[model samples]
Target: MTRSLPALMLGAALVGLSAPAALAQSAPMEMHAMTAAPALNLSAYGEVKVAPDMATITFGVMTEAPTAQAAMADNARRMQEVFAALGRAGIADRDIQTSGLNLSPQYDYVQNEPPKLRGYQASNRVTVNIMDLTKVGTTADAVVSAGVNQIDGIAFGLKDPKAAEDQARVLAVRALQDKARLYAQALGVELGAVRTLNEGGGYQPPQPMPMYAARMQMAESDSTPVAAGQLAVRIDITGTYDLGR
Candidate 1:
């Protein structure tokens, strides 16, 4: 037996589907059609305090001698020690990056004389990422003890920051809702569904507070106190809502 929908039933189904769409399409694109026109926008700044799961140390070797070759040899010898220590600490070669290298003449200045060129200086910088935080302090100490004189800086941050970013997004949404509610209450209008949303800014990862003087010397025995302060992840959202009548 062949069965077909009646004209009336088919007409009703079509009408039901089209009605809401039609309303949505022709619902008077009103950017401004309300009493006591009020625009309320809110922004919130939230921070998450997390111990740095990872750390980075930028330090290099600087050597000076009467000859360029001698300077380079000194630099290479000390740098090899640094690499050896890093390997002992279980830092993979892939995580180590040779950031910079330079060889220049050492110049001396006199009160009333032309600058005299003393010798050649060879410098090389290496950047290493320590995946393990438990050994960050000791690792830093080890590197310095191995003749890494110039500790450019030590920074701490998260390896995976997606979780923190998600939390920040939720905070942004909640901030928007609070704004909407406050605006609706003040304008004596009902709260409405969001029609548009704009996120002006994304979350910024936590920055490491630089932890030491100009350079960390090898002689210092106390472990550097690295405090990973709270990282403020801010998300700015601009949202437009459909007003209720």
Candidate 2:
């Protein structure tokens, strides 16, 4: 005997398969309705001024000689002296880092001719982190006295900025929430849950201070003038809030 499905049973099976796709289409519509819900966008910025507690200075010794080996040797000797001076200034070995070391041949360009080899130049740059702001001037003096002929520049920063930045972020979010609530009240609508929160800004890294050619030299009585101005730690945030009926 041949057996076939009844018309009503076959129709029910087809409907069951298509029910999932119908739900899929309605799912997007539901999400679209949620996205289109009335909402308020708020942005707030917060900044806190804090005096720098630490300073970083980059300075080095540059030497020139007829041979690369000679130049390198002279540079090494001067750097060793500078390292000793830095150690005496209460800088830890971990805080002193060799930022750069290079040996390049000096070239002299002639009119319409190939460059001539003048001499070999070697440079060793060291970066020192001073935890005490009061030692900024004295440290610079010490390094210069120990034969740091080239100075890149100095930058002032905080040793730990996480706490300050966290406070700023909290303030920014609070300000944003306050604003959102005030707007909602004025518009005669209840404030609903937050739809989205975005961090628009945060603390900026330290920047190199201005370079002074005259400050690099000392006559054994002069100390480098280092002024660590207050750095601003800023935070900005944006929040989207849904409107309740």
Candidate 3:
């Protein structure tokens, strides 16, 4: 429907059309538009120490001869001696496992050297699981006395890692709590419910210092000095907490 314009002052009409002065008015806060609020995030890690109850020693024998048959025969002889020694040391047949065996021709590599096919080398490796920590030194010595030329590796580890891991987890949680308390106090606010929690995969069992240098000279020693240090477990956790005003 069409209607006639109302009779009004031209100046007043122009003033209405013009924008009004803000009169020192303040802009409403754009809290959502300006920036996001800060979030509380904290993380803590804890570790626990435990003595190792088990040890794994990988020892082997290497023999070389002009012929593969001869090398095999010698390997068998030495391995038998080692087996006897293990038995004497109170190791069960089940605890002793053969991990590797190899026979290969040795080669000499020199510049312009058509690799001289040296004597054939054969090796037999065994894994010894020792339940008693005290026997580690004696067993190593015995294996050497039995003609085991190669001590591949020795590691002291835990028989069960579950309980130790749980204990470390408790320590980690307490550490996170302490951090949250400190943060909340510094911020002058109360730490509220946890919004997020994440745990890093827990600790690995500690291992012995490697004794990789060949000990062929000690094949007939009274006893070798061995040290079994404490095993350590670690825990890590990250947490997010809501803050109360």
Candidate 4:
């Protein structure tokens, strides 16, 4: 049956109005379906302790004289001797690096008086990497005996950190998983697959040990007693896990 023109127009208007009303009624259900699922977020860390295999010692020679030229010359001569001593101690040239060199004028300070020029001082510093742990003590002594008057500090570390870091990473993941499981059980929810995983914190160097000129007390035949204590390698991880009934 053919509809009249006015009836057709009226029907088209009614259909347009009903379409929007139908969409409005379904919007809430669509939004509910799009809601995010329940999830648990957690962070954990792990550590592994192992003995250090290598050491680096930063030591220097300080020389003072009436003139800057004289002070620098004296410093250079003493530093040469120190280098030779290190060579004797089995430290290769590749391991030795000059860290710093400076020349400065010294001042004699007196109460209520202008500063007076005392002399000029020159200093040279070198950092040496010792691969052999047993030679650390004797190496320190050798440098001191050969003209290293000032010992700055000593640091111990691993030659290669990959293995240790990998071990730490495994431990960290296990810890994170265990924590997620525990939380899920306590909440009476089943633990689901990990939604996201993140990793952080690896291989931090140990703090330098404090060393002083006074501590290098030389015995007739004994080397300085250096204790290579254990070092801790750590790893941290964060993970998000899905939670379900």
Candidate 5:
């Protein structure tokens, strides 16, 4: 069937009106999809130094004899004397630990012949934690006098590092915050809450201080001297923040 001219014109007009309404309804949804959260990333580090409160002293007694038994016996006697002296100097038992012990046979090599047994060497080493920094020199002198043939070295350290580490972490966080604010300001964006944070750092133990050779004898007129320097702790942090326009 053929439609009349009036009905045909009315249908065309209704189709034109609905097209604009559909487009208007979809515009806001497209704008909402275009808007997204912006973000900024930053990192920072911090450090702190403090004097060491404790010292570690390592020394050993060595003895040689014709037989392993005799060498061990002599080493044990000298080590006992050293232990007694340490106790007299106010070193606690828990602070003293045996670090090494060995008994080896000395060898004599001859040309075109099998190696001959020369003698036996015995050694006993101990590591002592000296709580009193003032007594470090005195302790070294006393141990040397008590027949300690080997002085490995001395290391200065802290008894507790948690406080220092905590302080460093706080400093790192503050630095990160300041840096983030600077970046946001320069970029012309408002800084929002932290979106992500990560912390990283470590404690580096103090190295051993230089000391004389094991066989060097101490001068009777002067006491042994030691210097315990300061120790440093550090921390680092990485953070991400939301940037608002």
Candidate 6:
């Protein structure tokens, strides 16, 4: 049997009323789910100072002669002597690297006259890693005496920077946590667990220090003096911490 028109109308009205009630009941729950907890975002850095255990020195032999072949031959011979000196100074073949070798024509420029060819100049540059700090000065002296006329630069560094980087990472995390705590205390809130963490910076090698070739040419009785200063390893970190209470 079919329901009466009035009963059907009543049922439809009841259904409409229940739909709004259900939506109203669930609205607060949906809003609560969508709301995120308060977060404190912070960034911090850490640094560690350490003495360098090794050094890299770039030096070369420059030769000038009337002919290109003569200039190159002279440069090669002097480079050989420099290599021998390095070997005697306890530098391994693996530590020695040829950075550059160039031969160029020299010219004399005169006013109201075209450039005149003077001679050919050749240069052979080598970069050597000295593991022993004590031998740095002696090695320089030996190479200079053997045939190194150009001293490009010197850079000091660690044999292994992993330990230093890890130490800096620890310090960075501690600093971040401290900052979060301080912020939380200031806001009169409790610090919660770390929501996210990101790491950025790491160990960066220092730039090579300039050294004059004349200064490297000390007296025969005295070796070249080299000072390996301290190096700073740094770490940067950013974190997101939850706030509670």
On a 0 to 1 TM-score scale, where does candidate 6 land against the true structure? 0.84
Candidate whose TM-score is highest: 4
In candidate 5 the C-alpha lDDT for residue 211 amounts to: 67
TM-scores, each model vs. reference: 0.73, 0.82, 0.76, 0.87, 0.77, 0.84
lDDT of 1 by residue, 53-164 (tens): 7788888889899999999999999999999999988889998999999999989999999999999999999988889877777777777778887777777767887787
- For candidate 1, list the clashing residue pairs, or say none: none
Shift of residue 233 alpha carbon in model 6, Å: 1.1
Q: Local error of candidate 2 at 83, Å?
A: 0.5
Tens-digit lDDT track for model 2 on 32-105? 77777788998997788888899889888999999999999999998999999999999999999999999999
Runs with alpha carbons beyond 4 Å of true place in candidate 5: 1-38, 214-216
Consecutive 10-residue window with the lowest summed lDDT within model 3: 19-28
* Runs of candidate 2 exceeding 4 Å displacement: 1-35, 216-219
Per-residue alpha-carbon lDDT of candidate 4 for residues 65-167, written as tens digits (9 for 90 to 100): 9999999999999998999999999999999999999999999999999999999999999999999999998999999999998888899999999899999
**Global lDDT of each candidate:** 0.75, 0.87, 0.83, 0.92, 0.88, 0.92
- Candidate 4: worst 10 consecutive residues by lDDT? 211-220
* Cα lDDT of model 3 by residue, 1-245, tens digit: 12334444656787676644332232334444675444589999878888888888988899999999999999999999999999999898989999999999998899986998878999999999998988888888888888988886778888888899999999999999999989899999878888889999675644435665454345454456677778778888999888886
Candidate 6, residues 1-245: lDDT per residue as tens digits?
A: 36598898999999998999999999999999999989999999989999999999998899999999999999999898999989989999999999999999999999999999999999999999999999998998899889888888889999999999999999999999899999999999999999999999887777778887777767888877888989999999999999995
Off by over 4 Å in 3: 1-38, 109-113, 212-221
Count clashes in each candidate, considering only residues at least 3 apart in sequence or on different chains.
Answer: 0, 0, 0, 0, 0, 0
Candidates ranked by TM-score, best first? 4, 6, 2, 5, 3, 1
lDDT, model 6, position 244: 95
RMSD of each: 11.6, 4.3, 6.5, 3.6, 7.6, 4.1
Q: TM-score of the candidate numbered 4?
A: 0.87
Candidate rank order under lDDT: 4, 6, 5, 2, 3, 1
